[model samples]
Target: MHAMTLRLSPGDDLRAALDHAFRTHALSAAYVLQGIGSLSVARLRYAGRDDAAELRGDIEILTLAGTLSAQGPHLHMSIADADGRVVGGHVAPGCIVRTTAELVIAHLPGERYTREHDAATGFAELVIRAS
Candidate 1:
């Protein structure tokens, strides 16, 4: 596993940035080790919910981690508002950076990743393959 760090500037979309990284690095699969930063706006889908909840304000990114592949990123994040109220859920696009987002990604050069439908889970899931 190879690791790399990414710094996202203000106004950047969190999810979109992850996707762009793979293309830029020519990586087929990677995983987020950890992330911390601030978000001016966050879009998250709470557990068991289908739609995303939009939170706006000075938000502190408490935690961020998940998988990244060509299919897309499957990230989960926790954030806190200025009042210290915390919320977490599936990471979604439109999570705008407030100042900067520092993220570390682990690249798997020997493996490939794809998302395929899983009948049991009723959702597409990660499938790892030999590169």
Candidate 2:
């Protein structure tokens, strides 16, 4: 596993910047180690939910983890508002960075990742081939 440290700028958007990083690094797959930062405006959609709810206030990212694929990332995050009210959900499109987000990403071998249809789940999922 190769690790990289990333620093998000004040005006940088979280997912957007990460997407750029993937492209720049030519990464086929990666995972967020953990993220710690603040967000002035956060938009999160928890799994099993149809839509995202907008959060407008000071918030801190508690836990951030996800998978980066060719299709995109399937990220989830837990955040707390100014009052320490915590909420977690599926990462949506509107999670804007406030001050900065310091995070680490680990890249996996490109050939190790493959997709195949699964009858049980009825979807194309990651299938790690044996080395």
Candidate 3:
């Protein structure tokens, strides 16, 4: 595994930026080991929910971790609002960075990751393969 750190700037879309990195690096598989930063807006899909809950304000990203695949990123994050209330769920697009987002990503060179539909789960799930 090869590891690297990335810093995202203000107004950048967190999910998009990470996706871009995955493409730019030509990585077949990767995992977000850790992430910390702030966001002006956060779109999170809560457990058992079909849509994302939008949170707008000075938000602190408490945790960020997930896998990156050809289909995109499957990430989960915990964020704290100005009031210090914390909520966590699946990360969604349009999560705009407030100031910065620092991330540690590990690239798995020998493995390939993909998402395929799982009948039992009723959602796409990760599929691993040797590259």
Candidate 4:
């Protein structure tokens, strides 16, 4: 496994930046080990919810982790607002960075990661395979 750290600038979309890194690195399989930063806007889908909840403010990213695949990223994060109220859920697009975001990602060599629909879960799920 190869590990790399990424720094995202202000105004960057958190998920989009990670996706870009996955493509830029030409990674077949990778996982976001951790992330820390702040977000001016966050879109998160709470459990059992269909849509995302938009949180806007000086939001601090307490935790972030997930897999990265060609299909997309399956990320989850916990964050705290300026008032210190914490919330966590599925990471969605449009999570704009407030200042900076530092992420460490692990790239697995010779492995392929994909997402396929699973009837059991009724959602697309991670599928790992040898490349």
Off by over 4 Å in 2: 110-131
TM-score of each: 0.98, 0.86, 0.99, 0.99
What clash count goes with each model?
0, 1, 0, 0
lDDT by residue (tens digit), candidate 4, 1-131: 99999999999999999999999999999999999999999999999999999999899999999999999999999999999999999999999999999999999998999999999999999999999
**Model 3 reaches what TM-score against the true structure?**
0.99
Which candidate number maximizes lDDT?
3
Model 4, C-alpha of 20: deviation from truth (Å): 0.5
Q: What is the C-alpha RMSD of each candidate to the true structure, in Å?
A: 0.6, 2.3, 0.5, 0.5
lDDT of 1 by residue, 4-115 (tens): 9999999999999999998789898899999999999999999999999999999999999999988999999999999999999999889999999999999999999999
Q: Enumerate residue pairs that collide in model 4.
A: none
lDDT of all predictions: 0.96, 0.81, 0.98, 0.97
Q: Candidate 1 lDDT (Cα, whole model)? A: 0.96
> Whose lDDT is higher: candidate 1's or candidate 4's?
4
Residue 121 displacement in candidate 4 (angstroms):
1.1
Q: For candidate 1, which ten residues in a row score worst on lDDT?
A: 22-31
lDDT string, candidate 2, 5-59, tens digits: 9989776778877778877888877888899998888888876777999998788
Q: Name model 1 segments beyond 4 Å from true.
A: none
What tens-digit string does per-residue lDDT give for candidate 3 at 28-51? 999999999999999999999989
Which runs of model 4 end up more than 4 angstroms from their true locations?
Answer: none
